[model samples]
Target: MTLLLDSEEGARAWIGEAFAPTARQWQQLDRFGAMLVAENARQNLISASTIPTLWVRHIADSAQLLSFDRDNEGLWIDLGSGPGLPGLVVAILCDRPMLLVESRKRRCDFLRAVVAEFDLRHVEVAEAPLERIETRPASTISARAFAPLDKLIGLSTRFSNESTRWLLPKGRNAVKELALLPEAWQRMFHVEQSRTDAESWILVGVGQIGAKQRGK
Candidate 1:
């Protein structure tokens, strides 16, 4: 894997090269980053140590998921979206309809505040866990540090159909987590090196996942 985007400037340049956000989108992202920093002091939104590299570690890390789902077909469900990682980031950058599922009330409030602040009409917040949320098909499903691969698949399989795409940022454990899945599920997903970290990885999968076969 290549070196990570270590500096803010490098992250900006990479984002520009990849997505080329409009002026308005850039403004939204900037404000969102500020909000995230401010909120982090009150709640554990993200690691305090990563504050210096917020752009590269969090913002860009989340933004990178968009590349995997360029078609933007239908609803994008972000499970356990504590601080909206890619879900809110994706909403700010584009008009993809999104549902951010976060179980905690405080985080849900924060997410709703961001949606209202930005007037992100395309996004919705489900203030509940994955199991309690109503079942509906999703075009793309994303999870970051939500759960291990087997448990994550079992919990999320209900929302996916044949065409749903899974974009999970499992960090450095991406390969190990994918390896632990049953053989069929192992075939359903593959790992992609993260642009922001050489050792980190993102799990990408297309097609629906089955729940029954997921076990130890």
Candidate 2:
């Protein structure tokens, strides 16, 4: 795969024909996007300026996280899932069970409302911060613009095991931020250029007992 692409067309090209959403999925996404815009009027969720780029910047950017999960069966835990970017988007698009964890009460309320509005049975939202959350092991974990690589490990280690698949999207400074990681984590991560922006990257990792045991 090319990893990085030129535009939304390039992103669609990269995802290919099979990734097209069903009519129902598209409806849910549309509803969610409209809801986000309406809710933004109530409080700060996403920046108002970015609303014009909502489809590509927020929706497509979030939806692409699932491409890394080939099997598409297993729990997906989205850490600090504010406004449910990939978490809610993924839940809307896929059948896999998912967990969306957000600390803020209003965001959590919005997430729950979205879940109810869509009647999505496979998605669950946790209103606690990652530190306080005691949840089951997840086979896949994702975070977007939430925290740096090192600190994210500290926050999400419990949700992972040797088989967990991580799909963390780090914009622009991915390599630089990745370089700051401890030596042990260097072995486990592979960087993929983002479809939305060439400067961005998605960091993919498979959890290993060795990395965990070594205190990574």
Please identify model 2 stretches exceeding 4 Å from their true place.
1-18, 209-216
lDDT of 2 by residue, 119-145 (tens): 999998888878888858899999996
Q: Residues 29-145, candidate 1: write the lDDT tens digits.
A: 999999999998899999999999999998999989998889867999999999999899988877878999999999999999999998999999999878999999999999987
lDDT scores of the candidates, listed in order: 0.89, 0.82
Candidate 2 matches the true fold with a TM-score of 0.90
TM-score of each: 0.95, 0.90
